[model samples]
Target chain A: MSALFDYTLRLADSALILGHRLSEWIGHAPLLEEELALGNLALDLIGQARALYAYAGAVEGKGRDEDALAYLRDCGQFRNLLLVEQPNGDFAVTIARQLLYSAFAHPFWRDLARSRDATLAAIAAKAEKESAYHLRHAGEWLIRLGDGTAESHRRAQAALDTLWPYVGELFESDAVEEALVNQGIAVDPAALRPEWERSVQAIIAEATLAAPAGTGMQSGGRIGRHSEHLGHLLATMQFLQRAYPGASW
Target chain B: MSAGLRERALAAASGVVDPEIPVLTIADLGVLRAVRLAGDTVEIEITPTYSGCPAMRVIEQELATALRAAGIGKFRIATVLSPAWTTDWLSKEGRRKLAEFGIAPPAGISRRSHFGTDAVACPRCGSAETERISEFGSTACKALYRCRRCAEPFDYFKCH
Candidate 1:
């Protein structure tokens, strides 16, 4: 049960953090269409995060609800991937980050849709379609920005290079999920790599963007050791609950 | 009496129109999945068109109001995720209503729709020559498109 809680929280935190990151683009997107697209994407991610948190709360059999789990947790306790918490940079950087993350997430949610746990399976079933849209949106931008112009190509490639090292952490397997994987309740993160690689490589090739050579990979976010960005993000995200303690609209 | 009450509750729930798209009722949109009576309480199941559809809360509230107006005192709204809502579930009547309302309903089910490759007809001019402006529109379930023939911008209820 604890393992399930940890595993679910990991998924929830990543979605919440990424959704919040995307929401920052509101009123700042380059175009009205892009603004709506980003907002919709963020909405889907945050919605999925809420469902996961609710499921985790129920699994823990504690009094903690989704609100408590999301806004009450401190930075050291969050279990999201470091890639999601990385600051959204330029338009190219944002698209690159989304492409990298959604490439993995689309396949992850599809596979997870078949999980033995009914609640997780249900959430994944809904999320898989949403992630497919997210992946397509990101991939389209990646190709456009990567191959459009010399400056765009340079920025896109630079963004990819800067974010690639963080990709390795997404596939790292740990004992926390091993038991659930064996029980068919959790997906093996390592198993998702080949498909993720194939999908990402095809997009990169089409975009005329060279894939970065494998660098010294970053890890530890799964264990709640996140980059410095997460603390600041959480301070802003958790402000309402932290300040008011159980305050509601 | 309970069966009649269940039928009444279903009727009231079915009459509730979507907050985002007022032309379509919950029944027409296929979001209202099931309704039944468990003793004195009414149980209603609804599926969200999108995971983050903000209109869901409004729909729930409107449902409560509808039920109360119908004299239903106790009811519960449950959100079901399996068999996730799809554009295919949009009733034929719903599709017609959307078109009459100046929105192109989903053309068909195609994976290519995700990339805006599938051609959607313009609801206004009835022309099949349309270009996608964006894969998202005013709502999550729609994509923005423009008719080259008519030079009119419109919304396409994207096939999910």
Candidate 2:
């Protein structure tokens, strides 16, 4: 596969898995409006995934369109970050992951939204706008959960404590970043780490939540290596694709 | 008479406004990703921005009814999962349509976020002095921005 496809698949896979997880909250969210909000964010993620996949398809000139890439891809092929595929866990865990992912993504999309490449830049430009909203929503909830009831606060704090470990993987960079950034095809996540930390700390502070002490980093989610949760997600997501095999609507 | 079906179908589809942003039609939001004349069954592909968006089914039914009222034929509004819809697809014309309806569109800042993209002028007052209030706006799909120059609140359809 071409580097373009790999890079694009990484972006698409991140959103696809995360979006699928968020969709689980459609009717089960804490509040009705929130349920709607999560759904909205999920759609945005799916949309971003689509654009990346479609563009990748177009770039690779693969007969495999966006649907093919999304619905047909096998388990090992997905390259989403580990945090995204992790189960929504408890509300706090969900927010923790949301905060981590969206924090990194907020800046990531902001930069990519203005890409040197028109197609990618255009897609990023669009995704950044949505990411801003997602960050805000998750941030507010983070504050509420951190400050709400004692149980809520305790759970939220614990959630962050566990999730904090995995957060490091998002900023992990290697050859892909080197190649893509040097070529201006991808933005460097390393540069965004400082801002992400500051923003997360500030939000945690305002929520009266102490930032959890960092533990050893749990890395390896971005490069097709993920937490245990992703395989189960693929089993569900790919079921129709695998079962039907080239079935189209 | 047959052409009238196409006209009516579009009008009905126009009635398929966004459930969140009710002022704008599906067409206005560009959520109407594609409309195809696949034989007699008109195939409509909608790329919704939000997952399980409540509006999708409504919009699909709306399109069906709108086209039905126009009286030509059968159509299936399919949700395309891949190449998920992005705000970038929200056209400049669509942005204008949204504003005319009193909703603000995303600032759609330049794709470069490393050094700097040109300042996003206010859609309300064309003021470069605008500031982002929140990355998340009223909807999950947009960001909140305020213009100091105009002192008005507006939404920036997120770049993604």
Among these predictions, the greatest lDDT belongs to 1
- For the candidates in turn, chain A alone yields TM-scores of 0.98, 0.95
Which 10 consecutive positions of candidate 1 chain B have the poorest summed lDDT?
A: B109-118
Q: A205, model 1: CA deviation in Å?
A: 1.1
For model 2, residues B90-154, the per-residue Cα lDDT tens digits are 76777887767655665553242321223456777877797765554466666567789989977
| Candidate 1 docking quality: incorrect, acceptable, medium or high | medium
- The TM-scores of all predictions, comma-separated, are 0.98, 0.69
Q: Write the per-residue lDDT of candidate 1 for residues B78-115, one digit (tens) a residue.
A: 99998888888889999999999999988886353335
Give lDDT tens digits, candidate 2, residues A43-155.
88887887788888888885879888888766677887877887888878888788889888989987986566777876776677567767877888888888899998899
In angstroms, the error of model 1 at A62 is 1.9
Candidate maximizing DockQ: 1
Best by TM-score: 1
